[model samples]
Target: MTHQLTRRQFGAITTGLGATLLLAACGTSATPTSAQKASAGDKFKKASLTFAFWGNPVRNAYTDQIIKNYEKAHPTITVAQQPGEWATYWTKLSTQVAGGTAPDIIQMDQAYIAEYGGRGALADLSTIESIDTKPLKSTLDEGRLNGKLYGIPTGNNAYAVCVNKTLFEKAGVEVPDDKTWTWDDYLDTAHKLTQGSGGAFRGTNWFGADQELKIWLYQRGEDLYTKDGKLGASVDNLTEFFAFVQKLFTSGDGPTNDGYATDIAAAVEQTLFGTNKVAMCWMWSNQITAYQKANGGDCALLRPPSKAGSADKNGVYYKASMYWSISSRSKAPAQAGGLVNEFLNSTSAAALQLAERGVPANPDVLAVVKPKLSATDQLAVDYMDAIKDEITNVPPVPPKGTSTVGTVAQRHEQDVIFGRATPVAAAKAFKSEVEGLIASA
Candidate 1:
């Protein structure tokens, strides 16, 4: 399994605007009239709208039901629902944007919101009065770029370690209790776990650059980029991180960068942790379902190991998941805004989000849905909840060209591990390149 971003990765880099218009279903109302509301009758004007998102079939089904319910309640508005697999969603959506036929409402990854929103592709939803603007009060406030709210975050996500309990037991290594565990404890256990398993297994596997190391650096009181959009952190932190990974690589404790990439793609049962080759792996919280599918045996989630010798109580920050935005070119801005509000604030929409989306952003939705969540989903919910108060900052919307910077940071480290570049040289080069990207951004 190559753990790389899918074909949609291209969509991250380019913009396009070619897509077919999907009209809302038949007899849908266009807008709500005062008279219609006074009569307690279906008042929404007859209108057609399209919503586009990327997800698996289960998520698609849940979204469909949400749309169906909205249609039933209004009876005069028709919604055309479009779902794409991760591999194709970005490319297709980019094409729609380029062709000037983008969906009225689009589900967007937070990373691209800055680039697209900055380009006038996304409308400022704050201007719409139909939105509750309360449940997402904080979220909406952050999506603002140059003083406009372009996207609304759907919910929060964060990276965590998922350990194979069976592998831990088999290796005679103890899994650290989440609340008390530190980086040393995790690494110490990992060292033993890999050693005891011989060459057949390792301690951890996954992308280490931006996801694992940057977060670690933050916990250590450093950041990758500066407030002025220049390089902020020094090479020392990255060098230290690479040295640790190098030790793991040499000791056969962690897969090499390439090996880790393979595992990412296959996500197969035989790839280390999936096949019981490793004891731990880093994954987004939303991945619990995939992990459960790949490895049928018992597994447990844990916090990322804390930084060494740090007083900062917060080790991990909540990642605002994807954002929902309306195309500035959309003909039905008000209708799209209404849909966004309904999806985020309604009981029925909450149910759909619980089953399909990882967690709803609305606290009210979460309150109603928590009791019904599956064990894995509830784990994500609880983990995010535990860190909610501690989350200090959300990484700002990445600049246009820097979408590649996060991935490139990983490659630079890979080059160091492969002995293609010395750590200092790699760090210096990375700093210069990232600073240049931001400067041009």
Candidate 2:
């Protein structure tokens, strides 16, 4: 009988696999120096590997096709596919790592690169001579930890404001020029959008995300994490950040706490922006396709607003959408690295995956795939290319244990918005909590 597995069921199954394998996801460990380094002329022996990734079913299908093509080219190697939703993928992978049965090749995220790479859970990609780093030289630095490359960027993305053009026109609002727009201008436009919609819609739905704070910090010549792995932005900067968000919530320019909660819980197809209840929202450039598909309207991408008088608008940077890394414990490291090289540089693989993962990091592959992208994807590509020269260097890879900062920021911001705490109090609490996390790590 054919059976479909629910997310919970899939997690349950993977949990058993993890226990048997003894894998731990993110934890403290001394770096291991035992992995065999691959030479340029090393030949991959015929082997089997388990490749794991987190994505929707559509992405799984695309990945399956790409794997099929890779197998056709190299018939001696076999890859077993393990796909799961993002919410549980890391947990399962961690368990597998601890059990020593981790997938051969892992789909990694920037948020946990420091955690995994620092702990020696990932193989150092610098030893893999088959993969070419020249095309994406500018982006390769993001996957580094202590000057060692652990992950290869699968694609590149950037944060931006996604607008429902149809909603903006219907509300009689002129789209602000992204080049000259400031944070104050963004607020005014949002307020105007709310008033024009006669309270039926909001101007934006993204006042609480930590990404906004990251951009704000960069604009002020600070960052979420310093190069030395400390909290870079001062407490006062965090206070201002929370205060601005609180103002947006109180001014009716954005969703209320309860409203925002409801919006977040809804499916993508039913989100406020998807339903045309918000004219704009902040999102990764790579997410434009799904947002536009859900909104069923003409969606436009705009750069995030800069500080009004600051001559240097350094808020923009290319972010690694995700990365491909091989587990250090993989029995077939050579074959696994070969697959990653193909995934990154093969023309056939790029043709099929296109920007589904994000814009191809390889310049040559990007050129080949640009014309094949959908309209919304083309917009993302053009947006990234246009801003490439203006953005600052990529921010430091998030420090170990720093992933919890996002949750802390969200909780404190919600508290301030709901009047449970003043912005200053929340900011102080956030600073203390984040420092504690970093110290504990």
Per-candidate TM-score against the hidden true structure: 0.85, 0.90
lDDT of 2: 0.79
Q: Which segments of model 2 are wrong by more than 4 Å?
A: 1-36, 309-314
Ten contiguous residues minimizing lDDT sum, candidate 1: 34-43
TM-score: which candidate is best? Answer: 2
Please provide, for model 2 over 1-441, each residue's C-alpha lDDT reduced to its tens digit, 9 standing for 90 to 100.
Answer: 001233353345344533433333344232333235554444356889899998887789989999988888778888999998877787787777766777989998887787677766777887766567777787888899888898888998888899998888888999998888888988999999998998778899963555778889988878988877888878889999989988889888888678786775566778888888899987788878888999898998888888853323848778888899888877677778888888888888888888877788788898889999889999999989888878774788888767656657778988898899998999899988888877866
The superposed Cα distance between candidate 1 and the true structure at residue 302, in angstroms, equals: 1.3
